[model samples]
Structures are given as C-alpha cells and as structure tokens.
Target: MASIVPAEKIDVIRRIEQLAVGAGLAAIVQTAIKLGIPDSFDDGSVTVDELAKSAQAEPGTLGRLMRALTVHGVFDEVEPGRYTHNDLSRYLREDAPIPIKYLVLWMGAAWTWEAWPRLTDAIRTGKAVIPDIYGKDFYSYLGAEGAAGMGDFMKAMTAITALSAAPIVDGFDLTGVGSVADIAGGQGRLLVELMERFPHVSGTLFDLETVVANADPKLLPGGALADRTTIVHGDLYDKVPVDVDLYILKNILDAPNQQSDRALLNIKESAKPGAKVVIIDALMDASVEELRVTTLVDLFLLLNVGGARHNTKEFEILFEKAGLKFLGIKPVPGTFPTQHLAEALVP
Candidate 1:
C-alpha cells in the first residue's frame, strides 16, 4: 500500500493540487463570463436551469461549471441548485461598473492561452515566442485580426489602467505643474481623470495618431477639458511634446532595456531642465507577491513585446544612462493594485 502522507506534507500536496487545476479554475470563470451566466443572476438568485437557459447551455453541464466556480468563490449557491452574485461574480456582470469581462476574455483568449506553454522556449532563446508561435507579433496579430479582438484587448487594458489611475491620482502630488504629457495614454482615461482632478493643469495627450484618432467620445466627456487638453500624436521614440513640466510614462517601460533607454533619452532630451519624468509600473522587489505579478508581467513583455520590468537598481541605471537623475520612488496606496511611482528628473 502507498505510505500515508505526513500532515506537514499534506498542505504542500494540497497546494500542488490547487496549482495543478488552476487553469481549469480559470477556464470555469472565463466560461461563466463568456456564457453570460453571471448576467442571469443580476436580478437575484437564479437556478442553474435559468442560468443554463439564459446562457443557452445544458442544465447539467452548466451546474457542474457553477459548482466548480462556487468552490473558488466566483459565485454563491444560496440554495440547492440556485446561484446568486457573490462579490467576485458581480464584477463579471455584462454591465459591471468595473467591467472585468474583457479581462477574463483576453486572458482566456486562444492566442494568449497558447503562449503560456511556450514559456520555456522564451526563457531559453531570450526572445519573444509569440511571433514564432502565432506567426506574428502580438499587436500585428491583433490588428490583422481586426477591431473586435483588438477592442476587447484594449478594453481589458483600459480597465486595468482605470484601476491603477485612481490610487495614482490620489497618491501623487501634481501641484503647480503647468502642463503634462501622458506618453502612450490610451483612450485618454488616465489623463482625463488627472485633468478633472486638476482643472488648472492644462494637458497634452501624446500618443500614436491612430490611437488619438479613435479616442473621441472616451477622451474626457466634457467641454471642461476642451481648452485644457491637446491630443498630440507622435511616436515617443521620435518625439513627445517638448517643455512639458511633467511627462507621465505609465506602464510604458515594458520594452527591451535598450529600447527603453532610447525612449527615455528621447523624453529626457525634449524635457526642459528639472522637468519630472514619472514612470508608473510594478517595480520588481523582494516580496513574493510583488515578484509573482511583476515577474510574470516581465515575462509577458519578453514573450510578446521586448520589454521587462525594472527594479530600483535597474531604474537607477536606466535613469543615469538617459541623462536623467533618479528622484526616488513612491508607492501608490489602496489595495486595488500596487504600483511604484518612479520619479526622475531631466538634468
């Protein structure tokens, strides 16, 4: 007979088991969102039959999926065979205020899902495998696939940027800054939020012409910013709005170190003396959780884009090399998502 496992080893075994089925768990959640199963519960408690009917799924199979998600707190079975929205499940609602449906969709998308298995190849080659695996770079594929898929990906990214923007706007001080440039500010979400917060601060929304062209309706919803915000279109490596007091490069450094250096140098050269270059990203650290998310994102950049996350030391080196002085780093508070604000100055 097999030897009985020790109690200490039991937790480890359980952890391993959990990790083993993690993908299936993620798939369950994704399916629930995709099927609009959570939408059925919005009115109140819903039977599996109702959820299945609404989602056009068979009752028995849908019930199994719901049961698996319930075990992981994605939904609550209030009564036998009936489900209701729990805290987690509510966010998957089709019209959730903080819509994560897109995130679920993107994460579970075929291309992204397929790339994970090639992680070892990426590490070995020190190059992105997405192009090799998918026959195109990620963005090119997204573009070629047409707007629907790209829109979903952009929506997911916008949701993530929205979550991070609040803590940043509240945490960082932006007083007396005459003008600001949000480099690669997609859809103008963060810049709009910041502009709303500081009415006196005129802003320039600098990004690709294509990106800015599609940014109407989502680029701050009022005339208040009409006079204050200018949507300037250009590549960051080539040019940014010069002489801006503050230039925000939120989550833009996820490139190969050399490319990041060139981009930083471009910004530094354009920036007037003593201007601030604020970089917002998850700076790598010693904490396990920090390492987990940041390193995975770093790997993601490596696999798809050619970018990587920077530790403080790495940022220090990048800043020094780019003709900018490291000003220090600040942590954005609130548990939604923690990212470090690395401030540097053009010398």
Candidate 2:
C-alpha cells in the first residue's frame, strides 16, 4: 500500500493533471455522441468523410476529431483513410445494452459539466451544484427542460439501471420471496426482468405517474405475473406502497440532508416488521482503485449531484437512522460493479 503524503507533491499534481486530461477527452466524446455520430457509425466501417457526411458534420473538421478518438482507441484507423468502430465505441451504437451514448451526452451536457468548475462552491456551502447550474433542483430541472428532455431523462435513467441493477439481481437470494416492490423504480425494467427470470416472484413497480405513463408498455406484457405486476403512481417521498417483501431501491436517494432523511423514513414506514430492504448504490472501499476509473466515479456523483460515495459504515448508519438494521453487504463478482448490494431488515 502507498500513502499520499502532501509533501509528495509530484504524485498529487500528476493525479490532478490526469483528471483534467480525462475530463477534456470526455468532453470531446460527449459532444460527438450528442451530435449522433456514434449512432450513425453502427452500420459498418466508414471513413471520416462518410461518417461526417451521414452525421451532417463538416468533413474536414470531423476528420481531425476521428483522428483524435482513433489515437485513443475509440476508433481504429484500419488503413490510411479507413476507420472502424472499436470496442469502446461499440457501446455508443444504438443497439448496445445500456447504451451510454445518451447517458454520456446527458452527463456531459453544458448544465452538468459547468457545475464541476464550481466544485468549491458546493464544498464550501454544502449545497448541490445542480441548483446552481440549472436554477432548480435536479429533479425539478428535469421537468423544466420540457417533455423531450424529460423523455431523455427517463431513457438515461433506464440505461443506468440496466447497468447498475446487476449487483442486486446477482447477489441476493430470492428463495421464498414471492413479491417485490421497486421503490422509485422508474419504468419497471428491473421488475420485469425479475419476474421473467424467477417465475415464482412477482413485482410491483412504484414510481411517479408521469414515469409510469412514459414507460414502454412492452415491458409489462399482460400474462400470469403480468396480472401480478403492479404500478403505483406516487412519490417515494410521500409514501411507498405497502405489504410486499423484498423492497429494492435501485440507485435512489441523492438529495439534501432532510430529503435523504425523509426517504429513509418513508421506506421504514412502508415495510412490515422483518421485511428485507435492499439498497443498491455505489459503496467506496479501500480497494476502489482495483476497479477501473471508480475513484473518478465517486467524484462524478459528488461534483455533479452533491452526492459523495459512501462506505459500508456510512450505509449502516443510514439504515440505523431510519430504524433498520444491517443484514449484510456483499461484493458482486465477475463484472464492472459501480455499486455494492447492501441488504437490511426493518426492526
């Protein structure tokens, strides 16, 4: 193990410089995706001229950008003027699972990226930079962006859930659990998958009315558990639906002090005695470096959303604060895990 002594200024400065370079590269990729170039490239290999033409970009200018991304392995310069999509770029394609194309574009949008420049403001005032950036709370700002942008938000969250939901689905045992409620679960994608895989287990997806309306009904095909699949239109802050074991909160709970407090309280009230409450979220550990780019991800939540990554101890305290006790915390293996599955029981 190595210690980051402040007196070791060279190491610290190198790390800071790396972060800046990475952020710049991210900005370029973000701009390209938002312009729909990646989605256009999925048809097959194409030269920069072809890519730019189809993407409606200036051919000469796009040539330089493709060279830049190619140097970094996003695209491969197959020959002097031919280029092909690489592994990293493939995820930006339309059919890719958890297509990060929109997610990256959303996160790197001017509103979000602008907030990082004022990271100090959030740290000093203990206020979220989201309101500072968007002139409203993050969730409210989603509405202010108009229906199209709200649709983007829903799609972006669905993509995120597809990636983050694996930990809970893989680590937990659902042996006797017949029904589950996904609290603040938008669109019910996870619930649909749960019901499909474990036929014995049914699910109720509780989310906002707008969210339910926007959800693709294909996810809720009417059938055996389709009758069992339920959608409760309400806010998790107000009330969570009752009388179901195995409540899961997938990537929820980033807010001001009181907001987080109220959310936990609501979950506690919704649960019966001894019901399992599963929390799936990013959990920092001493070995965060073991996972690729995970440390930067911690800061991403903090600078963007005023949310800092927490360790098991922080989560345990959160559970105890809301009258719940920790059952266990487990690391999901064989995947790029951005979260830890922490299960607790309401006392």
lDDT of 2 by residue, 1-347 (tens): 55565656877788888776977788778767766777776646788778777878898888888877888778788886678778888888778877767677666666666777787887797667777666787767766776666776677777877775555477768977887988888877777667777778868888777787765574456545567777777877787766688888867754443656677788788778878888777666746464355555555666655666667888787788887888888776643555667888888
Cα deviation in Å at residue 186, candidate 1?
A: 1.3
Show the lowest summed lDDT stretch of 10 residues, model 2. 286-295
Task: Give all candidate RMSDs, comma-separated.
Answer: 2.3, 4.7
Off by over 4 Å in 2: 1-18, 42-44, 164-167, 216-225, 290-292, 303-305
Clashing residue pairs found in predicted model 2: none
**lDDT of each residue in 1-347, candidate 1, tens digit only:** 65499767899999999889878977998888879787765757888888888999999998999889998998888888988888888888878887778888877777768787888998888888878976887666776767676777778877888887777888667776888888877777788888888877888877766567656353534656777878788878776655699998887887778878888988887888978988887777747866765677788778777568778788778888898889898778862457788888888
lDDT of each: 0.79, 0.73
Angstrom error at residue 95, model 2: 1.3
Best by lDDT: 1
TM-score per prediction, in order, is 0.91, 0.86
Residues forming the 10-long window of minimal summed lDDT in candidate 1? 214-223
